[model samples]
Structures are given as structure tokens and as C-alpha cells.
Target: MNTINVVIIDDEFIVSETLKSYIEEYTPNLNILSVINKPNDAKEIISKLKPDLIFLDIQMPILNGFELLKSFEEINFDIIFTTAYNNYAIEAFKVNAFDYLLKPINVNELQNTIHRYYLKKKNNPLFQYGQVKSLLEKINTPNKTERITVPEIGGLTILQTSEIICLKSDYGYTDIYCKNGSKITSSKALKHFCSLLKNHPDFYEIGKSGIINLNYISKYYNEGTIILENNIKVSVPRRSRKAFLETLQIQ
Candidate 1:
């Protein structure tokens, strides 16, 4: 197996060190070229070493991962972004077909991500710098509509917030129901989507495990039951029933 040179750029010392240890112990095919804590020095080091893959952190002082990439005229390396769950960043990565690992990194996910990268490299020699460029543009542009990236088999599915009828928590995963009569299972937890759509006007949390889109509501009963599009029913807990009814102006 050919060794893939790698560089890790994260501001947190512990995070970078933990990742380094995981890679060293688990993935023998990947060589750790450098673990850089300073985002400012990353450009010079990356330019000098020219590693095959980069493990980049999204939020950093002085220069962020996106800004660091923007400094490059032509990107020749693949990137796997590391970030604490940020809806916008995750959406951008998914939309652009880039790989990302959520922080407090899971060892199994790390190994799987690296394995997938190796497979992709073996099958397709072409690098996707255009996707990176597009991601940067998306970040810079103002979006009027809200959207979320649903992780599916093989790749990601981008759904407009309006298209979603409701979200149901199924243990560790979230089951998303769409207006188009399709269901998507996402690895993200219910709280993740709740946090993502918190500020949006149309989405309301029905209980601990469900969120329903206000626009999709077809009927609401005084007994704290909501009937949505496609005849889907969601129950509102007694504690939140008053607020839920007020939101619908049914009182």
C-alpha cells in the first residue's frame, strides 16, 4: 500500500494531538507530515510539504480553514474538515462533496473517512478544486432560503428547509420526512437539526424527539395533536402544548 502524506491544521493542541495519535495507532498507510496549531503558519508549511491530504479545522483565529484555502490560487490536495457541529459549515462541505468529521472525534469514523479517501483516490485520480471554490462562493453569498444536508448512503442529499415535512428522532439517528413523500435517515441527532432550524419561523419542536414544519400543518386538535401534510400525526407534550397552540394562533 502506498503511503499518503498528511498535514493536520488545528488551533487546539489537544485536538490535533488526539487526531495524530489516532492516525498513528490505527491508520498505518497515512503518514503524518506535520501537526500545525497555528493557522498563520499553515500556508507556508502546506506549500513547502505539498501533502496529499489535509485535516483542516474550520474555526480558528488569525485565519480560518476557508480563508487559508482561499489564499491558494490552485488547490491540489484533498481536504477533510474538522469542526464542532455548525449547520452552515456542514451544509457547505456536504454540498461540495468534501469529507468532514465532527469534533470529539470518533475513532471508528476517523478510520472510515480515511478508508473512503483511499478508495476514492484509487478509483479517481482527479482532484476537485472546483468544489472547494464553489463552497467558498456559497459561504460568501447571502442565502434567502434555509437548507440542510441529509447524509444518505454513498453521498449527501441537500434539502430545502421548506421541503421537509417533519423530523423524527430514531435513537441516535434522525428520520426526515419530506414533502415529496420520501424518507431520509440521517446520522445527525435530533438536537442538531433543532439547533440548526431554531431561528427559522416555520419549524417548531413538537416534543423531545420531533420537529414539525408549520407550513405543513393541515390540522391541529385542542388535545395537542397536529396533523401535517400526507396525514402524518405528531403529538405535542402537555408542557409545550400552550406555546405550540399560541404559535399556530389556535387559542
Candidate 2:
């Protein structure tokens, strides 16, 4: 029966405000933590607000919801992605995000999301925290990643996690290189993807700039440089010495 703290973020001023009003009117047990229009600002507020639920927009000018998710090193809150597009819906479910709601929002759906959020948390706070930890580990690994669901940019194509050969950070965004020798730019960070790659033994984070799957390594030499299956050599960073050796030994 305690009021749930919540925040909403959207690029559209009207949509954000409208959602805020609806929550206030329909959900009396909800406490308005804050509402923001920008993803970067939302990141800062999220650290301070620590809301139980975040209603996030998938598309925005500065940073999308996926990108904003990367900014939080630790995510202990549930998120409901609010978007007009349903293309990423299945992927959203794959990542185990709390729920998804389409734009021109439906009050009933919103209420259902909130109701589930409350019941889940109220009955099993520990379980929710465990899910958060699992999600973090799943996102931080370098290889052996599960399928990633990004908003379908072109047609209905969904990118599989196994297709990724490597991940690298560029201008703050992550680039996913596939086995077919194609690359896609993602709004999320390499760190975020790394967290999601935990269960896969084939991937390893050798350094700060890159994460590579060992299955793609063509050769490993004494000098800490590895030749990938694609014939790209990656120099292991000095700090990762102990872990790199340990991982190698295990394999």
C-alpha cells in the first residue's frame, strides 16, 4: 500500500506531460518522482530519484531508451518502454524488460504494467533484485551473448546475438560486427552489451576498446595479440592480464 515512485521520459513534450497527467489521475498510489524530456538528463535524475518504475521512450534525439539504460551502472528498477513502434517488442521481451506499451498510450495497458510491477515487487522484492543482477551479468560479458532486440530500423529484420563477431565503442555508441562482415550501429554502449554477454564462454573482454569471441580467434601468440578467425589481431590490455590468462587456461 506504500506509494510507488515513478519517472517518465520522452522526447515529445506533449506525450511526456500527458503520460504524467494520466499517471497522477488514474494511479493515486503512485508518487511522481520526476519527468524529463532528454535521456542524458534522465540518467542524472535516475541516480537521484531511484524510482521503482521508469516509463521510457525508445526514440529520442540525444539518447534513446536503450542508450539511457547503459548509463546506469547498476539498475535496480523496473522499466516499461513506451514507444509508438512495435518492431522491438519481441526483443524487449527477450531482454526481460518489464513490459512494453505502444504510443498513443492505452490507460488499461499502463495500469496493467503498473499492477504487475507492484505485485511482483511487493511479493518478491528479493526476486526482483536477483533479476536485476542477472540482467547486469547478461549485459556485461564480451562473448556468448543471447539475442539482442534493437528497434527494427529498416524492415522486420531481427539481429541474432550469435551473429555478432565483435563489439567496439565509437563516439560513445557501440558497433556490432557480424559474421557476415556487416556492421550495425547501436545506441547502447559496449559495457551494456558486455553485461548482456555473460553466459557465453566464447566471448572475452580483452581490453577497454573491444570485446571479442574466442570462437573468432584464429591464433593466439605469446605477445598478448590474438589473430581472430577473421584475421584481425587484437592486443590484450595490460590490466586484463590475470583474467585473460585465467580465461585462456579454462578453455
Candidate 3:
């Protein structure tokens, strides 16, 4: 088995050391190339060493994980985010198909993640740099409305958030309907998109498995159903009915 070169970038010394020890103990095939505690120095070290994988912390003083990633013009290496962020932020990671470990990392989870990484490397040698780039763009641009990157088999499809008509959850995947009558199926879960579009004024979660663009809503029935553009109809659950009506300012 070939050894996988790894780098740990965390501002906290103890956290970084704990992760280092965990990798050394649990994953013998993984080689710890470097343990960087300073976010400022990470760029230079990572550029020089060019490890196969990086375990990056999201919260740091000088530069956070997203900011550090933005500094890199091209992300050739794979990233495994290590964060103590809340559920909303974790959803972003899931939507982007990025692997992440929560703080005080579980040994079993870490091992499993590494195993998955090995399998991914074996099956698909090419890393999806587009995902990382899209994530960075979302993080860097707070004012602008973010575009959604739909991950297809061959590559990624960037869609303006406004162009989305509605999304329906099919098992674990999401089917996105667009205004131009194009539908894109994404491997990400519905809850991920829910979190991703939570801040958007137009996008609203109507039912357990459906999200609708309020701007495209053409009709709403008192019986708890809404008709959006393209003749797409979605049911609004009782629990969400009040809030949905309130959003529409329907007295």
C-alpha cells in the first residue's frame, strides 16, 4: 500500500498535536508530512511540501480555513475540514461534498474518513477542484447572491440562484428544476440545500422534501398548496403553513 502524505493545519497547538497523534496511531498508511500551528505560515509550508491531503481547522485568529484556502490560486490537494462549527455551517460542507470532522474528533470517524479517501483516490484519481473553488467563492463573497454549483458526473454546472424554480428531494439526492425547463440532479441531500439557501429572501422550504423559489410562486391555495413557475406544484405542510403565509404577507 502506498503511503498517503498528510498535513495538519490548525492554530491551536494542542488540537493539532492531538490530530497528529490520532493519525499516527490509527492510520499507519498515512504519513504526517507537517503539523502547522500558525495560519500565516501555512501558505508557504503547504506550497513547498504540497501534501496529498490537508486537515484544516476552520476557526483561526489571523486567517480562517476558508480564507487560507482562498489564498491558493489552485487547490491541487484534497481537503478534510476540521471544525467546531454549528449545524448550519456543517450543511455547507455536506452540500459541497467536502469531508469534515467535528472538534474533539472521534477516532473511529477519522479512521473511516481516511478509508473513504483511499477508496476515492483508487476509483477516481482526479480531485474536484471546482468544489473547493465554489466553496471559497461563497465564503469570500457575502454581499453578492451566491450561485449554486451542481455536481454532475463529468464536471460542475454553475447556476444562478434566481434561475432555480424549485427543488424536490428524491431519497438522498435533490432534483433542481430551473426556469429554462432544465432539471439537474445533485447527490447532496435536501437539508443541505435548505441550509445553503436559508438566507436567500426568495428561496423558502415549503414541505419536508421540497423547497420553492418564492419569486416564481404564481398561486397559493388556502388548502395548503402552491403553484410555481413552469406549472410546478408543491404542498405546504401544516407546520410550515403559518410561516409560509407570513412570508407571503397573506393575512
TM-score of each: 0.56, 0.51, 0.55
Residues 16-124 of candidate 3: C-alpha lDDT, one tens digit per residue: 8879999999999999999998889999999999998999987565466887988898898999998765555677777777788877678999998888878877877
Q: Which stretches of candidate 2 lie over 4 Å from their true place?
A: 94-97, 126-251
- Tens digits of lDDT, candidate 1, 55-127: 9986555566787999999898889998764477688878877888887678999999988887877887664
lDDT (0 to 1) per candidate: 0.82, 0.69, 0.80
Worst 10 residues of 3 by lDDT: 137-146
Alpha-carbon lDDT of model 1:
0.82
Rank order (by lDDT, best first): 1, 3, 2
Write one digit per residue (lDDT tens) for candidate 2, span 1-251.
88879899886666777789889988899888898976778988988889987888765654656667767777787777786543344354457645677666778987887787777677877444445444435544223224554422332124666676777777777777788887777666677656556546777886777888767767777778877755666788777767887887887
Prediction 2 global C-alpha lDDT: 0.69
Colliding pairs, model 3: none
Better structure of 1 and 3 per lDDT: 1
Between 1 and 2, whose TM-score is larger?
1
Ranked by TM-score, top first:
1, 3, 2
Model 3 misplacement above 4 A: 139-251
Clash count per candidate: 0, 13, 0
